[model samples]
Target chain A: MFEYIVSKYNYWVYIFLMMLGLYGMIGKKNLVKKLIGMNIFQVAIILFYISIGSKVGASIPILTAEDLHGSANPLHYMNPLPHVLMLTAIVVGIATTGVALGIIIMVYNRYKTLAEDEILEIRKKSGV
Target chain B: MKVFALLTVIITGVMLVYGAEDFPKWGDPNQPGSVHVAPRYTQGTYIEAGTPNIVTSVVADYRGYDTMGETTVIFTAGMACILMLRKKKRGEGESNV
Candidate 1:
């Protein structure tokens, strides 16, 4: 059990972070807190992918001069796919956060509150 | 409601832990993620693109189309934000809600 835990501890840490973000998204009543949780969740996922691409003694995904001339060993460098995918993911996360913040601002302007429950209550009272 | 949320989080955590049991050890070179296409990229990046940085070459060369689409998505998102949040001039179809 200890060996298994030690071997896969990175996954466990990311899972724990994901759960924390999930809890914040689900339990928090404030709209901004929910956004923060969503950002955290995205970051955790990105970290998980980056961790998967790592190798024990590998350098970054840059080819050294020696590697370029000789047969490059895959094990000598980290996987590039996950890093590429995560770059896209990071951009999408930023775009999502920007749009969500914009919507939240619009909500605040109209309803004058950032709490989910209060916004719902205002909607109920207004019959909208 | 908070209790329900906590329960959901715990259940999700448990499920994730269970699923992660079969994952390869950290920094294991032979992990599935490092096999297949990754090896090709690692070995052939310099030959194919003359770029030393495999990640950069993949993103900007091999996957150029994907990055272009990603840029389009971001542009669309920025336009949506501007459309949704920009201030309106008075008496320009403004109404009290």
Candidate 2:
């Protein structure tokens, strides 16, 4: 059981990071902390993808004359799809972080408080 | 809370016992996902994409639309923040602040 779990450790890591990030994102009151938590959540997905794309014995895919000749021993080739996906995911994560931070700044400016409770009270008083 | 935890533990244990039967054999070649669907991409994604990588293809082509939408969600959030936080100028006073 231990060995089996070890072999699939990436999944475990992904789940752990995801849970941690989610907890922080949902449980944290400070806007900045929530943003950081969101980033953590996104990063977990990236890790999941990268791990999925990996093969134990794979080589990086780049064609060369030797590769064409077929003389090179074809042992293992690293999967590329997940890495590609990770790139997009990383970009999206950054965009989300930027937008989330922007919202935090806006919240700060309007309510002069980062606490969600404080903002909610202000909204109530303002009838907004 | 204690009852909830006990319930959860019992349910999880039951699932674990039954799930083993349904779970796909680890690294079974017959798995649909493991099959090499395309020749160029089949052997491995890195060789096919001319990049040193498989995840790339899945992200770039397999599910590119999903990623695009994820980015758009951020854009929408940013716009919402701007609109919500917009304040009237000092001369305009707090009428619309």
Candidate 3:
């Protein structure tokens, strides 16, 4: 029982974080808060991927002299693919957040408010 | 509406948690992720790219095209933000009155 829990505990933590972020994204009224939630969700996913790529006794993915002299064993080196992929994902997330914030600013300027409900009401009144 | 959103999120989370049970343990070396083409990338990175960092090798060597596309996406997004958010100056188009 203990072994099972210990083995999968990381997943449980990520799940909780994912849920919290999901709730914030869906239930929050403010656009900035929703953007924050999206950031949290992306971060949780990145952490989960990174954790999966880690090994118990592996070092960094950089190849050292010892690796060249001996057998090129994968067991000693952590997986590098996930890290590379997540690096791109993080950059994409930052770009997305910046665009999203800009759009939000435009929305606020046009509607004179930031709340979703208020924006909707204004749109309805204006037949937009 | 908030309650409905909460319910949906809870259900999605439960489903995701249940599905995660089938994933390989934290660091099983022989898992499919490590077994497939990843081994080639890890093994050949040094010879193929001469880069000490395997991540850098894979990103810049093996997946160069994808990285280029991603860079383009970032540029496009920046341009979009500027186009949408930049306001016109006060006297730019006012007929000089």
What order do you get sorting by TM-score, best first? Answer: 1, 3, 2
Order the candidates by lDDT, highest first — what do you get? 1, 3, 2
Q: Distance from true position, residue B39, model 1, in Å?
A: 1.2
| Candidate 1, B1-97: lDDT as tens digits | 9999999999999999989988889999998888989988888888888889898889999999999999999999999999888778777645521
- For model 1, the stretches where C-alpha displacement exceeds 4 angstroms are B93-97
Summarize candidate 1's per-residue lDDT along A1-128 as a digit string, tens digits: 79888888899899999999999999999999999999999999999999999999998888988988538998888898999999999998999899999989988888899999999999999998
> What TM-score results for chain B in every one of the models?
0.90, 0.53, 0.86
Predicted structure with the largest DockQ when compared to the true one: 1
lDDT of 1 at B42: 84
Q: Which of the predicted structures, 2 or 3, would earn the higher lDDT when compared with the native?
A: 3
lDDT per residue for candidate 2 within A1-128, as digits (tens), equals 88767666666656667666766666667788778878887888787666655555556644344454333333345544555556766776676666667667766766789987788888899898
Q: lDDT for model 1, please.
A: 0.91
Query: When only chain A is evaluated, what TM-score does every model earn?
Result: 0.97, 0.87, 0.93
Clashes counted in candidate 3 amount to 0
- Candidate 2 overall Cα lDDT vs. reference? 0.59
Please say which candidate is ahead in TM-score: 1 or 2. Answer: 1
Off by over 4 Å in 3: B89-97
lDDT of 3 by residue, A42-111 (tens): 9899988988788778889988875653256888888888898899999999999999999888888777
